[model samples]
Target: MTTSTQIDTERTDILEMLAKHRHFLRLTVRDLTDEQAGLRTTVSELCLGGLIKHVAAVESNWAGFIVNGPEEAPDFSSMTEEQIAQWGDAFKMLPGETLAGVLAEYEQVAARTDELVRTLPDLSVSQPLPEAPWFEPGGRWTARRTLMHIMTETAQHSGHADIIRESLDGAKSMG
Candidate 1:
């Protein structure tokens, strides 16, 4: 296959993986009662709502970084103190946050990223990683790598959500 065709194929695969991961994540939490979604187990501060929020925030960040270059810092500081505190892995879900809303927001992010990737040249062109302190310094990435990393991150956190959900109500993985 030509280089362009190869890039298109890889991008399609990455998007599919991301969609499946998001599907499982949503399914794992979808049937939880409000109280169950909010329950905290002995694991990290993450609850189901928190994991959903974290993935949403990271999707937005990764899409922006890929299209606009690495941000100097994460963009959560503009939020109120409470919002900032709940950013990423913090366990607090904002009032009125719902499973449907969380999924819609992340889906928008994914769509934008997919559009941007399709518009770009083949994935050989590199971009700097997001400037979050958690990432290794000087780690540049391709569009393929960006999508793959998002898929990986989502899959891992979705597992955490599964355990917490199961703890709350004896839920089991569908597969």
Candidate 2:
């Protein structure tokens, strides 16, 4: 196949995988109440609402990296106790945060990510990795790798959410 055709096919396949994983993740929280969605059913702190929030945040950040390079890194040393506390709860729904609102935000992020995936000039274009303890300094990643990372992140969290969901009410996402 021609280079253009190859890129087109890869793009289509990546988008399909992303959509499928997203659908599976969404299924974990479907028809759940706000309290149920936020329930920490597992020994881990993970909850369905939190997983949704985290995947949305992670995808948005990675997509931003693809379009705009790495964002300013946070200064953990300068953070206050309250700021540190807030960071720990970043994935979870805080008081007054509803499941519906979080789900809507996730949908918005997903739509924006889809548009980015469809319109980026070349998936092979590379960018420097953002500064994070979990990421190696000076590391660079291609747009294609970024999308795959997003897919893997979503799938991993989807599994965690599914387990949490099943624990919450025995509602399995898949058999």
C-alpha lDDT (0 to 100) for residue 18 of candidate 1: 82
Among these predictions, the greatest TM-score belongs to 2
User: Which numbered prediction scores highest in lDDT against the true structure?
Assistant: 2
lDDT of 2 by residue, 102-166 (tens): 98999999999999989999888989887668879899999999999999999999999888988
Q: Positional deviation of 85 in candidate 1, in angstroms?
A: 1.7
Model 1 lDDT per residue over 111-142, tens place? 88667666766666668775456778788987
Model 2: runs farther than 4 Å from truth? 72-80
Reference-based lDDT, each prediction: 0.72, 0.88
lDDT of 2 at 62: 86
Question: What lDDT is obtained when candidate 2 is compared to the true structure?
Answer: 0.88
Backbone N/Cα/C clashes per model: 0, 0
In model 1, the runs with Cα more than 4 Å from the true position are: 72-90, 130-134
